[model samples]
Target chain A: MTEQRTRRIDVPVLARVEGEGALEVTIRDGRIAHLALRIFEPPRLFERFLVGHHYSELPDLVARICGICPVAYQMSALDAIERLFAPDRQSPPARWVQRMRRLFYCGEWMQSHALHIHLLAAPDFLGFDSAPAMAARYGAELRRGLALQALGNRIISLFGARSVHPVGARAGGFRRAPSLQQAGALAAQAEQAVPAAEDLVRWTAALPLPAHPQQFNCVSLRHPAEYPMIGERIVAESGLDISVDDFEDHITEFQVPHSTALHALLEGKPYLVGPLARLNLNLDRLHPGVKALLAELDIEFPSHDMYHSIVARAVEILQALLEAREILADYAPQEPAHIDLQPRAGIARGASEAPRGLLWHRYDLDSAGIIAHARIVPPTSQNQPRIEADLADALVGVGLDEDEATLRHAGEMVIRNYDPCISCATHFLRLTLDR
Target chain B: MTMPPKPPAIGARRPRLAVHKFSSCDGCQLSLLNAGESLLALAERVDIVHFAEAGIVDEHAEADIALVEGSISTPEEQTRIQAVRSRSRWILSIGACATAGGPQALRNLGDSADWIASVYRRPDWISALPASSAIGAHVPVELELPGCPVSTEQVLAALTSLLAGAAPLTEQDKVCLECKRRGQVCVLVTKGEPCLGPVTVTGCGALCPGLGRDCYGCYGPAENPEVATLAERFGDLGLDAHAVARRFMYQQSGAQPFHRAARDWRQRARPAAPPAPGAESGAAPGPQPDGSTDSHD
Candidate 1:
């Protein structure tokens, strides 16, 4: 008599993901018994500790939350603060600030998306242990990715002194403006990288990506005219549209015992965010050239395949480059880089499309502009539930009887597909199979 | 300037480098990826056996150099840092979080649960140490590269020095030295801006001062920091006690020198006096060129 075999796939270290996490799945009788993605990273309690900080310090303070995407934190915080301080939708910073902010955000998307595709996600597609291992053979391609990433940093540094925890952004506007010569040089370089970025889109699409398409809700910020970086409206492919102010109404956050990060539900279900979600929701908002490039590559948006995220990031890189080149072309430095902020007593709400997903911030401030309450919903926290859902289905696809290494690699690939910023989510990856 | 990924010599072992994380944002380790053109060569120069963020995770792998980021925030982290210490020949704690306990160290002031409950609705579910501390507090560190996110050049410079069998030279002078070297105007003296440059360490190229903002000491305390004198100067600039304490306490609150001064200043903290409506709330203090604060009085 043969006893039913129990399979347990345990990955001691989950690599290529930020922060700390362990994925546990139990399979019995060829039926999924229990599956959970747990984050063991110690809680930093950013929202709680941020209570007493002056609104002026919010940008610098929140930027520490995630090292890779400080710009997103600064932008979301500033959006809420700026909206409260400004009497209207577009004053104080005026059109120039609005344009420059988009340009700056583009830089973030470029660097972040570029970094994820080549360094983080690409290794899985190439069947290499790491990017450096992939780099030895794909020298020119790796060089191009690195150069593009640097270009993104350089563009960010143009407005911000340095990309990582940049000291440039302020509530009203920027701390300093770049010189015309600096902007022009940057514009020219961005123009040159356009071809490379285009090739990146094609190259990613050409990779041997898996055809594991799964149904998931796609959520992102939707702008009226352009691809949403900072948006007034939050949207989902499920036809759920709400004001960014009413974000808490639709999305509810819950704590899971397995993870330090909070798992979130969108209208009581899992939803996807970030590049693919942005593309699925706002494909028309992409640059005409990028849209045309997608058409050229035979890659369609509104794709259900999760592995298409790499391609989505590449397409966005091209879009960001195009946007940066245009904004920098008409570069002119403005005096009084930021507007004088008047402390107002009110609840400030802001949301922006972080490279990972929708980053939302709400701060209750006293008349002194000091924070009375603060809540930050970074993208990673929002994606944890969705990532779990993806893993359950994706793992079943990989089959329960597979070897531990195969299951671990498959699980790693599935999570990395989300580009989960465990650090941002209070997140990491260690796989444990208790079958 | 990147070298091709070729073997150094037959049977020769390249120094193994491992990156470990604790309780901070994964920024400092990211600087290694941000090395851009030189990254491939650097990867070839050293065997990167363990860097979870970069997809290589061999936690127990012995390494010639271990680059550690983040602070000790959990019991699990305490054990992990020790394991890293035992395996590594040289451990370089990078960034303010790892070397100085980072911004999270602000929790070190009291029971972490006090603030933890505020952030998480179910605080009972959270598991963290009573206080966050620098990596040095748990295990002996070979070196400390202090920065909010240590500059890319600083990381390169330190790695270069260590790879050459030498000690990395870090500036022990005040941030005022950086401003002087770049001929940047002193914001504190000229505009009464509460810049931490006079007391904080140099490393950011005096980024804040040149940008017309005060340095908030993201790089931690300088050698023989006169923070008490700097605290007094902040008071002279019309900053209230709470505001002055916040400037020193927020980023690198775990640093000894700044901690002592901030503790002294926090004593005279505000008595919960509400800010008057339309008070000067912005980038600088006192007044603006446009008289935006005309109604404040």
Candidate 2:
């Protein structure tokens, strides 16, 4: 043992993920010495840009932040701003708006999740370089995946008029309600796809994921009555429950040296967010249909194995589809799609579960409905520390002395497992090696 | 130049396609993915050697056509775009970010360092340039398709034409033209909505205007058009000088025509010198309202 060998593993630009990021694993004494998930996705300075805009513009404006989950941004922004301008939110009309929002969010989760499972994560398990590279062999499965994704897009477009950066959502409600004819047709389609979604869960469960379980706190929004798409309060596996407004107090977002995105430490410790975390904490809140589907699968929630993330995503797609079907089934053409609001002043904070995880927004508005300042805490930033932690633990599990390519692949799988929305976080990865 | 569109793969090697990102929402890339089966069919027609989001990460891979998204916002990105240009035969800059500098380019009108400090805790950790710029500002762009998320139709049409070795048709017609062509009653004229359709290029089929909302110029300026006049009209529509200036500055703030129009309006409206893009960068509208305020209240 004259000199402990030193080497480095480098992934210059992370592939098959949402936004740009890099990872570096340093091997010293044949153990993982250092790990950094460098989120190099350029910060667009969204909060600063929001400063002078009118309250009405927020939905469309924040939607531009991340194309993958524009709905989440729109929903969260509206949730904050609307809660400020309009106090009477429990009226029948307001409840109508809430139901529509939940349905719209369902579409987004469906599209985002289907995309992750098929195009991004599936190839990793199937031993292919890319989804298209696996196209010829897995044609039907790929088509099924795309079809589900297309259906999700249709549901979003039904309300949004276009899926990516949809223009439908507004302060009080939507810009316009989708027609009954279109809404009914989509509901019928969603109903038929429930079994297809169930198939997806089984399909993901069969994937040869690595059985590497680790301990980390799981956090998600937990509502009393429903699986929270728009949540009331956040509850973690460690029983750290708090209101969305208390977020800044409990979850401190501090800048890190290696990444452009800030690292979020919940009470100064790394905690997990996104589908796995949501499933672990709120498995009981899932719809009966979803629960039955889960009952058929062997993998149970509260699963600490990070690979179960893909399975979580599949389960969520089913959950979204089932809910979308139920809500859309009774859809009607309302006279006015949106509720009008008078301008006012105050701090506005709203939180919702994006497909990736919790998205929280706080806006300070002037009396004239102008945004004075804004701050957004996207999920990927919160998960950054946890990702680095998981990478260090899992890298050793796969053997530290393994060749660079093997380690690189394993590292990518772990990150993609989170389905990290790096662009949303001012976020994401690229990897480098040192030994 | 107008070689009758011969089907691609006549006798030459299949063209390779690559997609790249700089600083964007990843919408434009998703537009390609959103093409669904057509995208998979595209994989058959060409080698998709790289597209980071969809799992091909051959960074140095060469290609016939490269679809680049996002704005160049950092020193490293300035160097990176040149490498992308060197590797690809044809480069199509997609979305407002890649073509017009996007909304982030609003800060291009201000000191970016100041903006970063206002937005982030540790400004030292963030590596950003003074200004965000379109890819063409740094490198030669074969074509620029401007949209907030870019139109999938335009991207698909461009792909087909480029693969056929023909120049993809670039639409320079104003949104007003498309709006009228689609029989949308002028919201600006009829409803006194401050629409940007007359100045904005047609790509979205005048979608916002059709939706009875003012055209926000998601697709930058349509070649050379009457921007100042339209912006002036916004003031006449009961908007104050600040509101009028912001319309031009909001979406494609770094595009030359819109940038100039916004600056001119702000200058004319203010007696004193106009402030920077985010004049109150350090401003935080105070703190919490005793922490929580529910809707029921």
Candidate 3:
């Protein structure tokens, strides 16, 4: 009788990120039997706690959800609640305020993506244990990436009034708009970052990706004028086009047994949304220079491999930088930062491109403009099922024993690829793997 | 003469800092990045040994100074905080979630199971324990930086203190103090609104009031707030005790002191236990289908 094999991978220490996580994979007889990315962090549900609060407080409240993408939370919450109170969308922010908002988002993308590519994603492909280790060996690549990220932060802080959650964005408009001097200062920095960002993209394009292709229903904002940011309709590669108001109609969120977050299915199916989706669907909307650079990379639209997300992120970095420059150039202090929002009682839905992906929020308000009910679906939660699918596929294809280190690394890479913000997922762990 | 041996420093290496996250929005940690160039400069002075958001490759790396973000929700997290506590020399809790269990702690106020069922389809797969609590509740936190997302300047200053081997600094006063300092007229007095600024802490720089709105209390309550006077004042402004209590419970519903005060006032104002849980976990205290407050309220 063959011994019933017990394969388990326990990553006591998860490297290359900001939080605490442990990944476990159990295999019996070579076929995959179990997989769990145990996040044993405490629960901090900002949504449920947001009750009875003024709609104006939401951006600040939700901003506490995660530190990396406070702007993402702030922007999404503001867009959603603003639409809820003002159904007609009467108080659209001025073009300059809108521009500043986009520029801030670009800074986040640059900082986040660079961190992912050089500090998070690069180590996995190069067979190194971590990015810092990779940096130690490839000093030039690491330095350039860091410089690019710093420049991105510089731009983001210019309009955000601070990094993380900027206090400037309110329901009607900014608390205060950036002075012309500030905009000009950011433009000068953007000029230096443009070439460097381009260089990073071209360099990343050369990295070898595993030849594993899976279908992804790329979803992003479809703006006719330019790349989507503050307000736009959502479009996906799978022939689903819906305004942010109708997001719930097409995408249904369900609770999964394995996770705390509500898994979202587009028309009852899993779909992709985030940087790759944004870059692929809105390629034509990119700046001419970015378009030229995209041509040089020779990457086709709707690239199937999830690994290509890095490349897509690079393209986005360029697009974001170019967009930021345009927004800054047209800066006009005279423009109103906010508009009058008369809160009418009803349901309002809004969607916006976060640095990570598309974030959607739904709010049901009473006659007094008080929120009666609220539902939020973040990008990472939507991507969890897809991540599990990809991880399972990788495990089956490899056909190796469940070696702890190998399984752990593979699992971390998969989760990190999506940049799974667990805070966004459950909002809502102690990792307990019952063997 | 032989060269004098290098004098040994009390602490050989710079205090390694590890930033940890559990269930949170990730805003406070992002504040470090939000610091712009200062973040990089700070990074140079002290090693950011471990930060998931900053993309530190080794999650298990040890640190002398550990800045914790988010609340403890799951049983696994309960155990993880113990480990995080063991690894670091000093643990500083950042943001509301760490210092006060955050708004997510609202789950602890009621049936967490209900939340799990309502929000998720497969409740069995989720391993979370019903109530999210503050990091200090579970771990020995050395310092607490309270805010929805703490200010970048605070973060920078905290790092500076750690590098210099001094304690991280914070104010004991409320947003009202800053409001007074800024010479802004009182929104509560003028607009007949209920502002948490009198009770809430000051780190946010009286932002909401400066915009002609009442403070939502992102900085948590001031040390020893005079709640009775504030409640009386609120009633004077035409808001009932219930409305005043509800507004006070807004963002920091999970923080015990505030949660308790709000519930106590509401119960006193209303003779009976409300049909629904008031400020309980998972049961959103918002109006029911009939547009009335739930039992928890």
Candidate 4:
């Protein structure tokens, strides 16, 4: 009789994914038996602390949930509180304020994508230990990436008052608006970075991506007039479209014994969100220049190829740069950056496209505008289940007989494709083997 | 000032720099990456043995300088920090979270398990200490840089100073001083806003006040802050006692001075007469006439 073969692989710590986590995979009799992605980061319990705070504090308070995407948190919180205070959809902030909000979001996308593409994910593809190591061979590319990231930070500072955890955004609109001169200066910077972003797109499009195609339920916010960065409805390719108010009803979060970050399921199944989902759902809504560039590059959309996320991020960087330039060209300083509104008892919901994917926030305010309860669902948590599913499937494809390094590398690639913000997800994993 | 002793030189080896995370938003460490050109320059001078955010992993590697971000809020983390301390020659606690337990430290005000129950359906699955604490509380720290997310310039400067065998010089002055240096008008005086600039630290370059908003005290507290005076000033600016307490309690609730001030203001905000039976209502402590609730208690 053949002896029963058993093997276990332990990734003691996961690197470059923000915060700490580990992955454990066990194989028995040449079949994958057990897998777990553990998140061991201590719980901050932001939702609980948010209780008893004033409505005005929600934006700033929620921003602390994730440093990499503070703008997403602020935007979501503002949307929810503003909807509650101003139920009339017609009475949204002035066109300029709305435009500035998108522009601010553009900065975040640029900064986050640039960081991930150059510093975090690129190293994996290049077979380097880290970006610093890659810099030795790709010096010019690294500089361009940093310059683009710096430009993003500048734009964030112009509106947010600081790059990380910006305090400029408030419940109604913003704490203050930048002057025309300031906006013009930023526009000049954006113009300078446009060529670099174009180069980035071309470069990423040329990368040697692995062909690991798989069916995915792509999810993103959708709007009628434009590509959705901030929108009212959550749409999925699998015939799932619901109002932001019904998000909790559609998506459920459950705690797994192995991970501190709660896993999320859409209609009781894993789904994907982020650049790929946004592009897939709103290909027609992309800017004309973006479409023209894609056409020139002979690239197709709605592809199931996960590795193409790097290229998608680069395309977004270009789009964000162009959009920022256009918005800043018509810059005007508006009075009353924020409108004063009395908070009333009500529940409100907000959702916006963070760099990674859709970030949703819900708040319950009391009669006196004090927060009675708060719930925040960051993109990373929503992607956690999807990442695990991708891992299990990819491992099966890679075969259990492969070396542990090969399996670990494949697993890291899958996780990094989602740009998982473990800090935002509030967890890490410690892989242990019992063989 | 007398010059400090120069760090001993290793014959042929560069210093190994390691960055550790506990419970933070990852912003403070990102500041190092945000340094851009300066960070690359620093990388040339030192070996980055471990920085998970940067894709570098060397968990057990010994470091010459260890920059720690976030606060300790779990038993496992407490053990991890001690292990990091044992392997490092110098440990510099970075950001508000590492220096004063961060905004999440607000959980220290109430039971952490209760907070978990309020947020999650299965609180039994959660494992956390009762209070979030700064790194210094568990082990010795060579230095502390305080900010909600520390400024990138400060991070670069600290690194440069350390490389040059000098102590990183940090100013302990209030944000008000920085505002004055920048020739900016006081939002508190001009707009009658409840700014914490007078008591908050200055590393942020007076960012909030310069943007025409009140200082929200993201830098925690300055050295020997006169919190009672600021509370009195806030009271004069139409903030009720509860509101005044909240200003101190929100961001740096775990810091000693801020924590004490919050408690003192809450005491002052208490009603002169006890509430009648059935009047508790479970409503937040004080309700202002302006339709805002001040529920610090």
Scored against the true structure, residue B46 in model 2 reaches a CA lDDT of 83
How high is each candidate's TM-score?
0.93, 0.93, 0.84, 0.94
Question: What TM-score does chain B alone reach in each candidate, compared with the true chain B?
Answer: 0.86, 0.88, 0.85, 0.88
Candidate 4: residue A42 lDDT (0-100) = 77
Task: Evaluate model 3: give its TM-score.
Answer: 0.84
lDDT of 4 by residue, B1-297 (tens): 123334424347898999999999899998988878887888899999999889889978999889999998888888999999999888888998898888878766655555565555555667787678889888877788888899888888887788877788877899999999999999999999999999898999898888888998888888778888988999999987767877876668777777777666665766752321211123232222111111111
List model 2 lDDT by residue over A276-352, tens digit each.
Answer: 99999988989898898788888877799999999999899998898899899889877588777776889898899
Please write out the lDDT profile of model 1 over residues A85-200, one tens digit for every residue.
77454664566888888888889999998899888999998899889889878889988998999999998888788899988998888988888898999989998999999999
- Candidates ranked, most accurate by lDDT first: 2, 1, 4, 3
Q: B1-297, model 1: which lDDT tens digit per residue?
A: 121122212136788989998898888988898898777889889999999888888999998888999988888898989999999888888999888788877766534544555455555767777577888777877778899999889999988887776677877888899999999988998989999998888888999888878898999888778888889889988998878878876778878777666655554553454432222121122122112101000
Better of 1 and 2 by lDDT: 2
lDDT (Cα, tens digit) per residue for candidate 3, span A282-309? 8778889988887867667667877788
- The DockQ values of the predictions, listed in order, are 0.37, 0.38, 0.29, 0.44
Where does model 1 sit among the CAPRI classes? acceptable
Candidate that would win on DockQ: 4
Q: Tell me how candidate 4 scores on lDDT.
A: 0.81
DockQ metric, candidate 3: 0.29
The order of the candidates by DockQ, greatest first, is 4, 2, 1, 3
**Per-candidate local distance difference test:** 0.82, 0.83, 0.69, 0.81
Candidate 4 lDDT at B19 equals 95
